[model samples]
Target: MAHSPSRVFAAVSPSAGDVYRDENQSVFNRGRKQTHLSAQSNVRVIEVTGCAEVSSPPDRACVSISVKNSKENVNDVTNSVTRRLEYILQTARQHDVKEENITVTKHLQRDEDLFHMQAEVLVVFLDFEKMQQARTVLIEKLDKSVCVGDPYYSHSAESLSLLRRRVCLEAVDNARLKASEACCILGQALGRPLLVREEESREWSSSQQDTSGSPLTLHPRTDPTLISASSRMFVTFELRPKDNNRRKF
Candidate 1:
């Protein structure tokens, strides 16, 4: 089957100096016929910057739980830590947390005759409410040796990728709108896009503020723990004088 030719776009920066001269001379001034065109005929190039942000509720949480035990014998301390960790895992499983989402690490230290063993559990929970319940139960039922840390919230990889793509497209649309508006004001007609460049992209929690100190609230009605994906684009488009009658390639 035959496929349509893919369009190629080139990004050009005004500050690129000699590179611009070389390309323009090579593409537009190869022969006398092309160079003989009216000096008044020119392609107006407009560059604009656009930005967009998208937000979605966090789909995952990282809950860290620490279990520590001290005993005169190494075997005793290890056994105590293992029991506490097993109980925590059982409680988490009962709350619908999958075994794959849980990670366990063991650390053993010897201070003279005393043996200290510690187990750290990092649980990735899909449901925030269930995670909260499990955390409460662990604290209430477990001994003082078990310590639970605050939850760190985030979006799943697939969800974050979707949001990033959406914001990037939106940013491009924003650039087009700005370019069209500028052309209208200058009494010129907008032409095909010469370049579309994504300058910066970032994903952060909506509960936190960005570097500008502004709240990243893309979805105000959703939970404050939502994740926000932001993108900035630099776009350049060709412009033609409104009265010009040259055909577009």
Candidate 2:
């Protein structure tokens, strides 16, 4: 691929130092609280949805394992992952997992310091039916191998993305319920939303260190002992503004 100058130059600089302290202080204000009023109008402006959050354990896991070795010994790491990954694959098959459900997305190498090299193996799940059972089998295998370097585990991101959409819908409904109750407390009519916003997050693996040069492509072996499944989610919400102006009692 031809290198693009714009892409290579993409970076955020943090060199600013107190360029507008007085301006910022003048524009920002805090420490003010809304006071409850007793002679409020019969009409109530209630946010149709203030905020809501709910979480469910993830349904699958994304496990990526790597074996690292010295700069001149790339084959050593390759050989290690081969035996281990093969065992993991075999165990998945033994548990009745379909062959097509597992995929090796990437195998690559990046240069490290003077004497070290970094190798990566990317694995992903296409079927979740046998996830739990496969996880048990894989964890047992990993423990026995005592694979060097830390094991990086995560909730299946693709799976969590689907879950997030559903959870968002439920949260919106929950927020509406709260809005209705707020109106009742003020003894005023709830207003329609004038504006809305939403936000969400996930516990991402720390960003990988940058690397340069050609990548190695390794065929993943079927290994039961070096891989597993898991799940995760972050609470999030939608907020809407309301205008209380009319009520019928």
Candidate 3:
């Protein structure tokens, strides 16, 4: 007779709970690794704001001239105003004022028993001395119908553009200097700039007067020709370890 074969049992299988626990631990470790890698890729940076201001003298002037006339005949009034305007234009051209700089804003003629005509002229002068001379000539040569107003001071467009550029450059330089100093104190080296932004920019005018009266009175008492510009910059710079051999955390 054949002996009965010994019964063999299968190895004990892992429980469902044990398998789930092992999978959860593996996922948790994977998440931790991803977080560590993300942290390492991000760089450390410092942010700073800098400001600068610059001032310059005025470079342009504006003068206003008004012409008015009234006569029983409309033609007479028109002719008189036209002559005065022609005289003014001729004088301006003689003084080297460009045609583009002259503007006639208003010209009106009302019809009535007594006709009336009125006109306003605006002339911009780049040369202050010529502007003064024009004013004097208009007063001396022109009749009472023509009136001359005070000069308005301002900076030319090109001058203002240059000033703005200079102020912005200064502000950026100031920000870089501050960043370098801060890095030195923290025992770190400054790396490439991460970001550069202009936060604020403005242009204004300021006036100063000389209270002390001196024998020489060539200059005006209140000088309104000073133009000022200011700018602010925000910069972010990367921070690196002073020792190049060591890696940053």
Task: Using lDDT, give the best candidate's number.
Answer: 1
Local accuracy of candidate 1 as per-residue lDDT tens digits, 97-125: 98899999999999998999999999988
Please list the Cα RMSD from the true structure of every candidate, rounded to 1 decimal place: 11.1, 17.9, 21.8
Model 2 TM-score (2 dp): 0.35
Candidate 2, lDDT over the whole model: 0.38
Candidate 1 TM-score to native:
0.55
Identify the runs in model 3 with alpha carbons over 4 angstroms from their true place. Answer: 1-46, 56-59, 105-113, 154-164, 181-190, 200-205, 208-227, 239-249
Task: For candidate 1, give the lDDT.
Answer: 0.68
Candidate that would win on TM-score: 3
Choose 1 or 2, whichever is better by lDDT: 1
lDDT of 3 by residue, 1-249 (tens): 011111111111111111101111321121222222123445555556777888767777778899999999878988999899888888888889999989875465567578888888889888889989999999999989999988877766798889889988888777777666656665676667767789888765556353232232224322445667778887766666677514321
User: Which of the two candidates, 1 or 3, achieves a greater TM-score against the reference?
Assistant: 3
Model 1 off-target regions past 4 Å?
1-51, 171-227, 230-249
TM-scores of the models, in the order given: 0.55, 0.35, 0.60
